[model samples]
Target: MTISALDLAAETKRLLTELGVSADRYIGGTLRVTSPVNGNEIGVLKEHSALEAKDAIEAAHQAFLEWRAVPAPKRGELVRLLGEELRAAKAALGRLVSIEVGKITSEGLGEVQEMIDICDFAVGLSRQLYGLTIATERSEHRMMESWHPLGVVGIISAFNFPVAVWSWNAALALVCGNSTVWKPSEKTPLTALAVQALFEKALKRFVAESGAAPANLSTLLIGGRDVGEALVDHPKVPLVSATGSTAMGRVVGPRLSQRFARSILELGGNNAAVICPTADLDLTLRGVAFSAMGTAGQRCTTLRRLFVHESVYDKLVPRLKTAYGSVSIGNPLETGTLVGPLIDKQAFTNMQSALEQARAAGGKVTGGERVENGAGDAFYVRPALVEMPAQTGPVEHETFAPILYVMKYTDFDQVLELHNAVPQGLSSSIFTNDMREAETFVSARGSDCGIANVNLGPSGAEIGGAFGGEKETGGGRESGSDAWKAYMRRATNTVNYGKTLPLAQGVRFDVE
Candidate 1:
């Protein structure tokens, strides 16, 4: 059973109000907000037009001028305050994530926790934005490089991780001394509004504690493709961090490149896992279960394909099938519910179409049936486990649902080939206790994904490591490590203390 539209709307309003968003602020527009958990119309948001999006970019650019001059540690204080606000309202914000995006209770809270984690990470990174000091060839010369803030950072986020992705970019962008303009997914605008409200509270606290902060330090543009285009094409926005499908990246990547602006594109992932003969069956079962079925398999790192050694394929497939049979699918807000509804009916149709194609390709599919929740329009589905003869056909494409395609492999070398065969290079993993196999999997020649792991699933990437992928995944990194460099510009400087005017490399200039 699912919550009624009226109840869901009431709860949504309550959460928003608690988070400091007024009713008139987000409502009174044609942009309808629907809850994926029960297919209920939660509310309506006034969508920003393309013109407003451009204006937002200009405003953020102006804010960047002032924010860039502030001390990095002072900028970090704002992020710290934002982290406190997120922690205080984590429960309400987490529930709002579930209400808007259909993530399970734990995952919903986990998303907010991710935001808080990035803020903590950014707070420390402010003082650590170190530059390099190079040893110069010339006598009495000092050469060094320093990083300075870039202009407006435009962030276009996807629905699966509605709020966390924005925080990933915004937090780092803030610490790096750049202002941010966010274009959240149209389907999940309410969470963005709530987050913006929380950010505003953090900003007020920041100003009270510190001296001043720019007016548009972080701007939220709630709209569809046109708004995203305005952000992408805006000349002032020097960096754009986009997280969505590869097709979206194909459009966004070149558009930024054409204008010589920077882009951090976190695109699609047809992630896979290899189960070796020496792998722990229990651990592999659990890893595969959560990686493929978690978030209804909507995550970018969702395990879409699996390659198992012929020695253990028989042992693991049955266990995986049993696990899939027991997943509880219902409203995401309900505790103990491991799985939740798909984002919409379109996602359900996509899953069915992929299953049909798998069948036509001589694949035997189990599960992938729809569950009847009391809410007629909500889509709850059984996660499908399909056994295929080869890694071809629909298996190569990411269906954005809980469908795991399993194939058998005899050799470790051959399995690696099958693993990197897909166009995506986001995340991959191998479950093996063998030290050589594990080392080889992460070695230069192994799994050609940005993230490769041994005895771990491809999903649930931590924020400490720079997150992104290569090839069609867009070659962009975000959240952690030196990713803050992408939001700032670098300058190399050389100073000569010697009085003599000497030319380097033994070059001589003669004057008459």
Candidate 2:
């Protein structure tokens, strides 16, 4: 059932009560959650102390000592139970995601579904963490590689995808027998709490059924910059998975590197799509519209730039303008609403500033003005379309708003260069009916983004494929397709029989 605003408040209160959290305990130090839908206060939460952050890391470290001893497939059974818990709480938690993160109802539910899907993927991967065997120079020696679980995994997620990103790392990290400490976005702590509550529920049942499992296998640290820094600087956290803006990744990537630790960073994406002359306009229209506007263009994979062949530029531009005009911008929980309010006033201001900058730079921009008709000061705005004469100024970087920049390209070579010119390489797509064109786009000489597509939008990546990007996007992989390897360390081993002191490369120094 779709959750309404009235029911959401009551449900949140009930959930807090059931989780043993009381507002009276928070007192003066509390975070007041205001609904972006109507600018009303949702709930106030007590932030975690900095010392508590250290305690959580120590707990995860203790858990890892026991967790890594559990067999791989047995760890899978625990994840399977967690998946079942997510399925049961999908509606209520999804509703919380919608209200807190400003996603439309469907997108909110879809994010929860991503959590469930990754759990399923991790369950299957438990038995499939394969290693490679190598040929040895000596006849009596056998050489092979084995995978061992790393210590604690620290996850820092962004507000755009409150729950799914955490699950992507947590599920794989858990199945690899590594405990995790998650620090979700300060803007969306309630969803994090809700998810932690559900995980504990599943963990309790699993322990009862399977004897003793590791305590504090998963933990939550809810606070702002100080708490996040505590996790990042902690010595026990060997692998830190962070998802946020490029500026944030620039800081996190180096800090983790300084300690010679591992980090998986899913940073900002200024993705684009190319529409060829041989493309199906009907299919192209839907792909471009959704990728450009989905999540109010807040996703890391949102389509920010569009390169259209000159032949169809006239036809596609007008259709796109109409589509942008027709999009319904209002409360995300309302039925049939396509575009929701910006996460806050600053997001609205950023959109406005970008539009103004485009106009000042002599680019023809349509739409993108604030929508004052919605809830009182709710920060709603129309998604924009800008026809740029050149890819200069604000069009070159991402503004984290519903602004799609359109440019015309005369040749395929020029289109490819334009598509790859941006610094961030997270996702890219092409719409073409020509087989050769599609093949070339997927080839090594083609798109440089981590994810490449044909006749499809760049947003909404599936869980089965490894999700990450190259270059400034951090060069880290997550989700599936052997991403589990990142959660473990590899060691090569050699065993010898037949009483021969055979050295590698047939060394003769041993004869002395």
**Candidate 2 residue pairs in clash (backbone atoms < 3 Å):** none
Q: After superposition, how far is residue 407 of candidate 2 from its true place, in Å?
A: 0.5
**Candidate No. with top TM-score:** 1
Best by lDDT: 1
lDDT of 2 by residue, 1-512 (tens): 32223445565676565544564532344777766766666677778887999998999999999999999999998899999999988887787888888899999999999999999999999999888899988888888999999999999999899899999999999999999999999777778888887888889888998868988899988789888888888999999999998999999988899999899999989999999999999999999999999889899999999999999999999999999999888778878989887888888888989998998887898899888753664677889999998787888898999999999999998888888888989999999999988998888988999999999989999999999998888898999898899999999998897686866666766544
The local distance difference test score of model 1 is 0.93
Instruction: Output the lDDT of residue 449, model 1.
Output: 95
Q: TM-scores of all models? A: 0.99, 0.96
Which parts of model 2 have CA positions greater than 4 angstroms off? 1-8, 15-28
